[model samples]
Each structure stands twice: as C-alpha cells, then as structure tokens.
Target: MMLSARLLLAATALCCFATTFAISMDGFATGHKCRCLTTTSEVIPTRLFRRIEILAPGPHCGNIEILVTLKSNNVVCVSPDEKWIIELIARISRNRQQKKPEVFSADQHVLK
Candidate 1:
C-alpha cells in the first residue's frame, strides 16, 4: 500500500509538471507570429503569386529576390532562376495589364 501511494504521488507530480510546462510554452508560441526568429533566407515554392516585387540588394549586395504574394495573402521570397516562377510572374503581369480599365476622355476618344 505504501508503494502504491508513492507511485500515485509521482504520477501526480509528473502531471502537474507537464501542465505547467505546457502553459509556459504557450506564451512563447505567440512570439513567432511574425516568424522573424527563423532564418530569413528561405525561398519557398508557390503555385500562384498574386504580386511580384523586385527589391535592390542593399549593403549586403545579395542577389535579387522575387517577393511573391500568394493567394492566401502570405508573402515569401522566390529565386529568379526558377523558370516556372518567372513564367508565373510574367503571366500575372500580363493578366494585370489585360484587366486594366479603359478610361474615356470627356471628348470620348476612348483613351487607349
């Protein structure tokens, strides 16, 4: 009976520790919402990029990165060497140009 009591106490202590650890770790998770703590060099693959932006390398003199904004509104960097990524960027730009609303001047020139 004494041994059983000790075992039960140990189990209770372990459960309390686990619960405390979990609660303590929960606060740290929110720190990663921006994810700036992670490596910034990752270039992810995206099927569809809603926007592509080219930024000049600053003091670091690094290669140009294609900032791809995915359909879900998340932004990530992509390499330009990937043919598919380049093609997708071109397609997006073309589609954007085609979707431009034509403006008509007061004179009705249909402002090409």
Candidate 2:
C-alpha cells in the first residue's frame, strides 16, 4: 500500500511539471509574433503625437512597424508605405539631426 501511494505521488508531480513546462513554452512561442494586428493609412498630425516608435523588421515580423502614441493616450499603428507616414519619418529625422549639439572646437575658443 505504501509503495502504491509513493508511485501515485511521483506521477502527479511529473504531470504538474510537464504541464507547467508546456504552458511556458507556448507563451514563449507566441510572444514573438508581431504586435500590430492592423494599421491605418489616415494621416495624423505630428502635433497630436506624444511619442513615436519605429520598429525594424526582424525574424518575428517581416514588416516595419510604426507605433504612435497620441496626446489622448491612445496608441495607433500607422502604415509605413503611406506617403504621409514617410514624410513624417523624414521630418522627424531632420529634426533629430538638427537638435544634436555641435562638438566644441578649440579653434572657436576665445583666448582669455
């Protein structure tokens, strides 16, 4: 009777371990899928955007993802192929470049 009880406990423990491992593996496999389920081509004004994220294509997803967070606290995915989206990206890039601080040069320093 004691031997049978021991075997039953071992079987239960093994089943629990296998179930937990399978659940974790399933989550890991699905976590890499693309975040965007749909994209909009409608133009959203830059002024309304509070944040913008550009995600490059990876093994998990084959398309570039543009995610915008608006001032209203809403997140939207914009289509990368849209003309307005392209222009928005260019404008943002230019702005970022212009905002970079110029390196200090010794030649420009006034002799004290």
Best by lDDT: 2
| Span of 10 residues, lowest total lDDT, candidate 2 | 22-31
Candidate 2 residue-wise lDDT, 46-66, digit = tens: 899999999999866778999
Model 1 clashing residue pairs (backbone): none
Q: Determine which window of 10 residues in candidate 1 has minimal summed lDDT.
A: 31-40
Judged by whole-model lDDT over C-alpha atoms, candidate 1 comes out at: 0.64
Off by over 4 Å in 1: 1-52, 56-62, 69-75, 109-112
Candidate 2 residues lying further than 4 Å off, grouped into runs, are: 1-28, 105-112
Q: What is candidate 1's lDDT per residue for 63-104, written digit by digit as tens?
A: 556666778897766666677666776987899999999887
Residue 87's C-alpha lDDT in candidate 1? 75
